[model samples]
Target: MATAKQPVTAPTVISVDDFLAGNPDERRRADAGRLRAIMGELTGEPAVMWGPSIVGFGSYHYTYESGRSGDAPLVGFSPRKQNLVLYLTGGGLEERDDALLARLGPHRAGQGCIYLRRLDDVDESVLRQLIERTVQVHRGVDGGSGR
Candidate 1:
């Protein structure tokens, strides 16, 4: 009589290589590779595909004040044709230092995401700091361990 509830967690299914292969454009593929390497090294976790596009690293569980809850990647990136979307969770951009972001080259931030047209468009060191700080904050919020 009751319908089954859909799973809240987006399981990591597609492998990094397989997902990268799905990108037909050579440049996009190369960008995905760079993102994979950067995120993998920052989170110290294996790269996992979230849904069809996002390549996520570590994951954490979150519950809203309204009671809905779900697990999401601590940090991730998607090699979209138009731009690279970086997912920086835990604390939003306002919580992060402004100087680091200023040095991050030409990019835009929305809520908890950073968008870049290309890897060369941003400073890698600043990007690394952003990812590291995001992961650390989320890990602390989730008790220092990812699911």
Candidate 2:
């Protein structure tokens, strides 16, 4: 008999209030609030906690070429000690995204993540554009299959 395949998605536990309240530092807490509002507005979805730290807005199912599959947020963020990490789904930023990031001010960009030391460190409008584009890209990728 074949063994049942295990799900790869992390349990969506932890409430947004609890997570924000749990932050000991006021600055980080405030930053989390800013991120939550931005992501919520961009995705037009309520924020949901993914795992223990990440606050995710929307979700999508993804399958790798190797057949490994999992569900993940279309956009999300985590307020960490060093920085606020923004997670953008559907892969890295495109050319237009790079232009927006250029105007976004002080920050770091990774494969699909954008890191900001504080909300004031960047242009909020540009950040919103980036998130909006990310949501559009991912939604188009899977036909808005997110929950």
Global CA lDDT computed for model 1: 0.79
Reference-based TM-score, model 1: 0.85
Screening candidate 2 with a backbone cut-off below 3 angstroms (N, C-alpha, C), the clashing residue pairs are none
Q: Write the per-residue lDDT of candidate 2 for residues 1-147, one digit (tens) a residue.
A: 999775544547668899888988899899999889879987889988888888888877777767777878889998988999988744546444678889999998877888899999899988888888778767775343222
Model 1: per-residue Cα lDDT over 40-129, one tens digit each: 888899888788778888788777667777878889888888888988854447455478888999988877788888888788998998
lDDT score for candidate 2 against the true structure: 0.80
Give the distance in Å from residue 134's predicted Cα in candidate 2 to where it truly belongs: 0.9
Each candidate: RMSD to true structure? 3.1, 3.2
Shift in Å, residue 55, candidate 2: 0.4
| Candidate closest to the true structure, highest lDDT | 2
Per-candidate clash tally: 0, 0
> Please, what is the TM-score per model?
0.85, 0.85
